[model samples]
Target: MTTLRIGIIGVGGIAQTRHIPAFLELRDQCTIMALSDVNIERARETAEKYRIPHVFENYHDLFSKVDAVCICTPNKFHAEISIAALEAGVHVLCEKPMALNVAEGEAMLSASIKADKVLAIGYHYRFMKEAQAAKKAMQDIGTPLVTRVQALRRRKVPGWGVFTNKDLQGGGSLIDYGCHLLDLALWLTGNQKPISITGSTYNRLSKTPNQINIWGEYDHDTFDVDDHVTAYIKFENGASMLFETSWAANIKDDQEHVSISGTNGGLSVFPFELYTAKNGMLLNSEAAWLPGNEDFGLSQAQNFVDACLGNAELIVQPHEALQVSQIIEAIYENDKS
Candidate 1:
């Protein structure tokens, strides 16, 4: 395998925690050549810690040195960075919400195709073993009856970062948390086209602006984003999805779940259980899942590396990612109108 030199942009928490570590795991196939962030000190620190050979105070500098980049910046910068990197002939594995809106995402897509480069999104849950197990169980259902998903967290607003700022991150819990389950559902259902979306967002919890927070405290008065969201989508294939997510909510379950109903079988994940009728009897089974899929960042990095070598196909293509952005934008519009 030719060593595919790599670079990382926006070396924030996600970059240090996931992307760098994933690249480290694929040392034989890739090298972490450069790191960049507007915060030069932090970028230098991350480069030192990760042992990447070079550090850039700006992303454009990193683009000149690496074959690909992992975009871990805020939603607003995603398109600009990905398009810039692609035009520079570098491949990209961008974080989800591919871009802030459909049009920007389309531009990102156009750049990727125009440059003839690999552009993949970090929809890591698709590779989760439980998710894979759920997809496999769908064979008997013939067609999906319903997709029930909840990606909830109780009073855990990430108030410390740009997450609470609507301008930088775009929207709140729906775009941040709910987008995961939404993408997972669409992927499992074979990404059948979507007909329309209806959704709503509420700022009920942190609206007071000076409110105390579980993750960190921020000016409550300036807390300008949703803390909770719910979306109802109808797929063209007749599969309907009901999604609920929150950074703060009055709910009991604080984790994630995707319960699917099919004609011959039903499956519930995040607990990895499968149910079906066989031999005139009902059967229940659960797969023993480990934390293997916990390395989605690494898996994505490896995928980009493999695609560079023509050894594998991209798991999340740019066009499919653009569709995800379209639905996301539609849901946001549905919430307001």
Candidate 2:
């Protein structure tokens, strides 16, 4: 087996907590050869801590040093960096949302096709054991008629990172946290093509003074992104999706759920339950066991590594990721209209 050399761009919290550790766990198959960040000091510190061999202030400088690169930068840089790395003959595993807009996502996809290197998005929720089981159960559900997804958090706005900055991260909970469940729902439904979308967004909670935030606190005056978003999407196949996501809500507790009603039956992801009718009686089944949270990240990393080495196919292709961006863009655009 040929070991792949990997480089990490943007040595921030996600890199330190998830991506780096995941790559390290697969040390026998791959190695973290280089690290880069806009903050040279941070990069150097991370390199020393991880015992990475090379550290560069610019990601381009570190690209040639590794066969694959993990782009964990903010949303604004996802497209530019991924395109550059792909052009440099390096496979890319980009952090989610793909890009700020559909155009950027299409451009990134184009570059990947032109470069002929693997481009995978970090929609790691698909790797969860329950998610895996739900996907299989979906096969038994028949054609989907409706998808209802909600990812709600109660006063848990992130206080760290550029999450609140609209220009930096694109949107708030929908793009950052909610996108995971959204992508999973769409993927499990086989990426049904959406014909139209109607949506609305709100930043009222984050912009209010004296707000209570569980994650920490950010400047209320500078909070310019959406803390909540709701949308109705109609797919070409006569299926429809009702989606709602929020970082701040008056709900009793946080909730994450994806339930799809199909022609034959229905399945919900949060509790990993399936519902159907058997012999004129209602039936509900739940998964007995699931892969741990840690394993999802590990499986995502392993899939990326395997794809880069030509040993397997990419599970999250660039075009599929681009569709996610397109839907998001439509939601935001529809809000303006």
Candidate 3:
């Protein structure tokens, strides 16, 4: 078994909390070979903490030391770093939203194709135990008619990182927090082509003075991204979706829900429920026990490593992730139009 050598770009919170630890846990399959960040000191400190061998301030310099790279950088850098890695003949596992928009995503996809290397997006929700179960249960639902996705957090706007920076992360709740469930819903529904999208975005709550927020505090005057977003989409296959996501809603609690109604039956993802009309009766089934790794980040890392070594297929393909970017871009564009 050839162990894959993996490098991590951007030694930030996501890298330390998710990517680095997950890859470290799979030592038998892959090794964390190198680390890089704009903050070279932080990268060196993270490398020392993880006992990783090589460290570089430039991601390009670090690419030569590893067979694959996990990009945990901001949305602005995802495309540039990914294209560079792919062109360098190294596999890439980029953090979600694929890119800031569809154009950059297409370039990343093209580079991967030209390089003949793997390009996987970090739609880690797909690796969740319940999400895995829901993928298989999708077969029972038949052709989907309508899908509903709600990724809401009540007054929990992130006060750390560049999450509020429109230029760095592209958008707020929709791109950062909501993209996970959106990607999962699209993947479960077979990546149907979106025909039309109608969306509305709001940041009035986030921009208000002295707002009550659960996640620290931020400058209300500089809050430029959307805190709440709602969209309705129509797919080419006659299916439609009602999507709503927020970072600062007046809702009761944080909710992450995805439910699909289909021609045959219906299913919900968060709790892994199945709704079917069986034997002339309406029934809802919930799994008392589910299989697969409970830690989705670990599962995602393992899958990326396996795919890099040609041992398994990527659950989040680049194009499917691009479709997600397409939908997100349309939503934002609709707001402007």
Candidate 4:
């Protein structure tokens, strides 16, 4: 039982809430050796709170002290830090959206290959019980024809952190919340090759003052990113997908859904249901008891550790994660056109 030494970069909300806790849960296999953040005070406080051994304001300094690093930085910095860590012979577990664009993702991938170290993306949604069950059930539904995805939140724009900053976070709802479902849908569908994408994004809600934001309140004057986005994607296999996501909408409640229609059956993720016609009657079946209480973040953490130790294959490879970024880039590019 070799305990892998791990460092954490960017001690932000995601690091504090998910990455730190998840790594702590795998104490038998890994230890939080150090932590780094642009905010030295925050890094020192987080290290003290979590009992981390070391703290550094520069991520580069922390890399030399740890065998692996978990990057929870803003999208713009993900590529630079990940590439450096990988080049330094350390495994990397980068938080989602992989990078701001496909080019940066490719660089990270290249560095991982050159370093011969594991590079895993933090698309923890794939570890969910419902998502796992849905993937297995896809065997019953042969040849998916279409995918429909929606991740909508009503008046829940995250008012904290750099989420509203386009420079730091890249985009808003689509890249922040929607990327999880997008990655999940692509993974569940076997990482289909996207042929084309058409998209439109809006920031009308974020620009409107006096809006009820459950997360908190942000500066409407500086809210320049998209709060809503819709897109249509066509895959190389002739399969098509329709996607819609938002941080705020005029809806009664938040909705998260992913459903695929195949030749034999159709399935939806949220409620975990299967629909098909048996004989002559239409039938809808729901999973009786799909385990839902397990900590996916912990599971993801363990997977990264195992992969780094050569005990298991990475469930979310960098190349697969790159496809998600490519589609996202395509969507934004299309919107610009």
Query: How does each model score on lDDT?
Result: 0.84, 0.92, 0.94, 0.92
Relative to the true structure, candidate 4 has a C-alpha RMSD (angstroms) of 1.3
Q: Model 2 shows how many backbone clashes? A: 0
Clashes of each: 4, 0, 0, 0
TM-score of each: 0.95, 0.98, 0.98, 0.97
- Candidate 4: Cα lDDT at 200: 98
104-208 in candidate 3: lDDT tens per residue?
999999999999999999999999888888999999988999999999999989999999999999999999989999999999999999999999999999999
lDDT of 1 by residue, 90-191 (tens): 989898889899989999999989999989898888777777777787786567879898999888889566998999999888778778887887777788
Candidate 1 off by > 4 Å: 209-212, 289-294
Q: Report the number of backbone clashes for model 4.
A: 0
Q: What digit string (tens of lDDT, one per residue) describes model 4 on residues 89-113?
A: 9999999989998899999999999
State the TM-score for model 1.
0.95
- Higher TM-score: candidate 3 or 4? 3
Model 2 C-alpha lDDT per residue in residues 1-337, reported as the tens digit of each score: 3999999999999999999999999999999999999999999999999899999998899987899999999999999999999999999999998999998999999999999999999999999888888988988899999999999999999999999999999999889988888899999999989998999999998899999899998999999999999999999999999999999988899999899999999999988999999898999998778345548888999999999988998878788888888888889899999
Off by over 4 Å in 3: 290-292
Clashing pairs in 3: none
Cα shift from native, residue 37, model 4 (Å)? 1.0
Q: In model 2, how large is the Cα lDDT of residue 84?
A: 95
